[model samples]
Target: MAQARENAVSEAPYYQGLAKSMMFTIALVSLAPLLGYALLSGYQYTTAYKEKVEAHLRELVLKHDQSVDSYLREKVAEVQVLGEVVGGDRLKAEAEITSLHNALVRSHGSDFVDLGIVNAAGVQVAYAGPYPLQGADYSNAEWFQAVKRRRVFVSDVIFGLRGVPHFIIALLVDVGGEQWVLKATLDFMAINDLVEDIRIGETGLAFITNRAAQFQTTPRRDMTGEVKLLHNILARGGEDSILGRGRAAITVVDDPVTGREVLFVTSPLKDGEWFMVYQQDTADAFAALYRIRNVGVAVLLLGTVCILAMAFLLSRRMARKVEVADQEKDMMNDQVVEAGKLASVGELAAGIAHEINNPVAIMVEEAGWVQDLLEEGLQKDDNEREVQRALTQIRSQGARCREITHKLLSFARKIDPTVERMCVNDLIREMAQFCEQRAKYANVRIETSLEDGVPQVEASQSEMQQVLLNLINNAIDAMDPGGGELDIMSRAEGGDVFISISDTGCGIPKANLQRIFDPFFTTKPVGKGTGLGLSIIYGIINKMGGDISVKSVVNKGTAFTIRLPASKEGMRCAAGNGAAGEQPPADGGRSEETGG
Candidate 1:
């Protein structure tokens, strides 16, 4: 079975290509999911990174707000302490108040712009430092009223009467039961420095806003006044932002000033009316994510290429394996076919030996009888008839021996096939004549249905006759217990002639059907039959550019059908064209059937 499979592969060159195609298909199927995963993961990573940047901005805004608030609270606390130490009415003394303001300003790091002492009636009784506002009226001022109501106030950036951008920190004190306010102006430089200290990603900017959504400390110091109101950003940002809500949170928005998509984090300062706004461009923030995506794509492409390369290499290896398998099969088939031919030759040799031995034995006995008569009487008249009979018997036996040797020589002669148009019925009749007595002895009935005017086939008569003879013998032998029918039929159809030999006998088993034409495979008992009969027959039909097939059922019957090209020219043309691979030429060749 393995050899037969190998031979089929050897005969068909396209099988290896088929194997390669299959491997390629499998490789593609395996790669589909992996490719999808790589693409999906890259997308997901970028999305997550965007979210992460927003989250980080949320943290940064809170920290920045804390720093600003800490500075403002410290300034407010210092003023509150001064109000407690100095009495309200006594602060009307300008030298004592001016010295105290100088000490406080010196202690407060460079943020203190100026200081003023105010009476309950909204009058600045004393003032010190950079601004000359000692006599400045606070009676109708907003800070004077706010300080009296709130006790302490950290105002947003504003220009004082001195025409400078300095926000105020005011503390209301009850000194000796007389209401007084210590009002200090904080330098805008300190607020600007505080907002600028928040460092974010590339293209990031930080700014502070009052409760009115007006920029307090703008990145562009030139736009730091009321003109830098964030009209669109605070308006479009939800109710919480519009209302100056205090919760620290992050949002994604398009910057109104820069018109770039950015991550915006809003955190309220300690005063509750101030906010620290941190904005980072989305493109800059997700830069690391882009690199990760690129690396993933590169690795994915590399893996896909490697997979395809391996698939190609493996497919080539598989194709080579198929090719090798085919070669081995052809060799094995050739070996089996040759073996069958040799075995058949050996069987034929034995049959001829038996034929020759019989005639030779008869001649020897007859010669002995003549010798005895000659010894008995040369002159006796009575022995003449007996001597003459012995001589005649010897002559007849010698002629029989010569005839048997001639038959043996004719059968042994290796001759090339002669391509000719011949009636298949005639060939069948002649071959059947040799096996008739054997069938009769076995109680087997021979039947023939030779169609008249059947198209002639292009074949070698001698080889065709041998093929028919082998099939007939096998059919007869299959009916081991006798009383079976053997039917031989010939017909013409579809530009071909079909000859079928069928037997009603013990049939071939299903398991053995495929192997029937294999060398030395037989169901017959030992020494009863050589398995080469069907093998030789198959080889002959195949060489003639014909096909043979068998149908059988166990214990019922078996039929073999042989199909040959109906017109001689058809087969002859096919042969001439070399259509039958590795077979003989159109003119002639022998079907090598021999016995051992």
Candidate 2:
């Protein structure tokens, strides 16, 4: 873990860049759709909501227009009935007209303000209720002229002699072959109430306007600036401005007065003489829509923040893991290079051993000849003792040289993977002997304990030899400079063969103990170690169905233990091969101690 942190620090820039790239990628992928959905859904909702509001306003104006028209027709019908029932004679009488006006007021609420009788000259001969102008001349009045042209006439709101806003509904009657107008004043406030009743959100109200853009009904608010704007709209719109479009026409324009966008719903009233209009500020109409949009934007922002945070953390963690893996890969590559160098050294040593073999054989032959000559003529005690001792030393040194060369040659041979029976004790003894000279040079002692009648294992002999050689060499190397004791032991118990090699040397630290068998992990100096010895040994043992473990204490010693399953077949085969069917040697179980 410490190593991993060091590596991360060393490659900080690389990991940081990786994290940044991943973070952006994650943010883009997450936010793109969210933003798109927000925009699309918001647009759709806004359009639909606006259409709904406008529709509601249009319907309200249309319904109120019909009500106003109906009110006017009822008043007209009442005037027509009075003229026909009372006849022109009674309608001209003040008392009769007063009785008719009172009856209208009682039956129809306050919709009717007064009643009057008009001659062909447009003179109001008789008037009843409220106003005191009993004989007003209407010879050129618009309603009087219009009523003469038609059987019934409902005038636009106007302030006639009484000087108040009201409209007159008049009926033309043929009384004794002469035309007279039966007129009734409709209450303007009654119609105004109908328009005023239309109320929606803030800034929503309705009013009635004539063709000249004159206000017929009292508006809820001042509409002086709106009147001129309406004049232009009605002028350009022509006769069917409101009716031709549909039941009601809707438009949105910036108000000249408020300088704010306003929605207008207009419908024709009284056969297009007046228009019922519903106006509202657009902002107020869509307040809920704008509110929902704001909330959605807030939620999107919050989600974006969460997505970015997660992306940053996740990317950083992933990059950290990648950095550690890269460090491990680099270490593995270095180990491979070291193993290659070790291979080259082994080839060089093999070549040197082959070259030295010829010369050593020639030297051995010369020593034998010298010994033969000394045995035949030398008789003096001092000279004979010296000559005999010298020859014995030469032969002994030559034999040692031959043994060393033979062992090197055997190790140089290619490994055989074929499984075969092998005695664990013998292999341990052989490795101990092979490392004995190196131990002597280091001044280290070699000790061996072999159990007699130990069970054999079935494995490749070359691989077993390699495993033992690696362990033994490591033990000798550990006890270098100032040598210590090296112990190799073998035993059989519980259906398994166990081999342990231990040495008293500068021990491995606890931090490195677990990683000792890992490839490319070593405590030795760079050039002196391949870091693959124990790892290779571990692989070989495990391949042959065996296990290997280690234990160490700093400045004390280290021990490696190997366990291989004992093969009963191999033991039986060994027994069958014994010479003359003799029992195995008793000395096999003995512990031998050798020192330099």
Candidate 3:
């Protein structure tokens, strides 16, 4: 019969495939949410950081704007006090106006570089300190025009008679219906100090620009009072919507002066004519953001690794379970195949036994009848003695044939076991006699140790005999090509009878120890083993409520031990019969032969 090979302890490919699939699923499930959370959190944190910077920049710009307003107010108020106290008509008296200008210069040396009194026609009527012009033309000048119209004006930085960059705070005074302008030149040193002191980062910058897109406070010392033409920073989207609209706003864009990516925050002065711009390198401003993003990435990667590790371990465990289940299923299939073979063999043996039984019986009767007739008809010695001896040989051979037929019948399913209490040691000794000739032929020794007090076991007498005979035959065969000792041992312990059959032969390997009981699994050469000897013995012992185990060492020896209940009380209860006896039937049927 064709049979499939059984595997009990190997990993299968399908199991690994399933584990891989499970790991993928787990990784996706775990990593998706982690990535999303990282992205969202990073974005929100960066946005908050930018907003905080914008708020701080606004506060700084507003404080600087207030300081600038106070400084200009103080200078302009001084000019007003001078114009009012020393009237414009008094300023026509050169001596008196010159005395007042000298006193002002002494009081405010850093702020009042020079003072000039100009008439409505823009001509300097009187001047003091530094300039030789007593009547310099002031008509058509931008400051003169602004003063005439607005009565007060703060001009952009310019280089006039002084030939140095400075601004003029002019006050318009009307005395006796004539307008005269008092103008004072103020340098931008104070404003520059304030802008420079506003600390941001290593690459941070601060500068002021006017409404006309002209730089009021120069961003760099080389570009002082020279930066004029520039685009409005706040009105990027639309000219009308965002221009000078926001009190303070922050943006990330390329800097016009540095031509590098920067974070620029604009805080328009309350006057609306000028604005303070704060610039920080984008890398510096958002460095915290980059750190946060890096942390998020690290956390996500770590979580993914942990999840994948868990998935791998869980999948491996599941794969092991699948492997074990497959091995069990294969073992079951092997058992089924073995059972079918046993059934078929039993039926064939029964049929053959029945066919040969009648002819063997007839031969035995005929041989006896000839021996009796020869003894009654023949006289004296002569041919009668030879005839009697021949008849006796025929009867003996016929009886041996009958015994063989009975042995085959015993293997048939139709024959039920008759459980009886029988001495295990006696059975072992009786079975060994059959193997003694074979041992002698091979020059092997048979040694036995039967404990004197070993109890009898309740079992099928014929089956027990067959079990011992099979074990002994296998032990003999294992020592092939050489002679070895076969050791048979019997003892009673714990109300159980134990029989150990051992041989000094090439032993079974450790790897195949468990598989030795499996049907058709044998290490013997082809045609030398049917591989069913041990399997059949296992089944028979289990049916009789006994246990069997084996131990072996390579190139040294192998041993098999069987355990059977030896108590008469337990046996009587187990078999439901009172068949404990010291002897078996007189037929002494031969055992069904099996190979190892």
lDDT for each candidate structure:
0.72, 0.77, 0.70
Give the per-residue lDDT digits (tens) of candidate 3, residues 31-140: 78887887788778878987786677777767776787777778888888888887777776667767877887778766676777888788888777676878989797
Q: What order do candidates take by TM-score, descending?
A: 1, 2, 3
Clashes of each: 12, 1, 2
Write one digit per residue (lDDT tens) for candidate 1, span 232-254: 44444445655554456566766
- Answer with 2 or 3, whichever has the higher TM-score: 2
Error of 1 at 441 (Å): 7.2
Give the best candidate by lDDT: 2
Candidate 3 residue-wise lDDT at 20: 86
Candidates 1 and 3 compared: the better one by TM-score is: 1
C-alpha root-mean-square deviation, each candidate: 8.4, 15.7, 15.5
Of models 1 and 2, which has the larger TM-score? 1
Q: What's the lDDT of the predicted structure labeled candidate 3?
A: 0.70
lDDT score for residue 504 of model 1: 95
**Model 2 lowest lDDT segment of ten:** 587-596
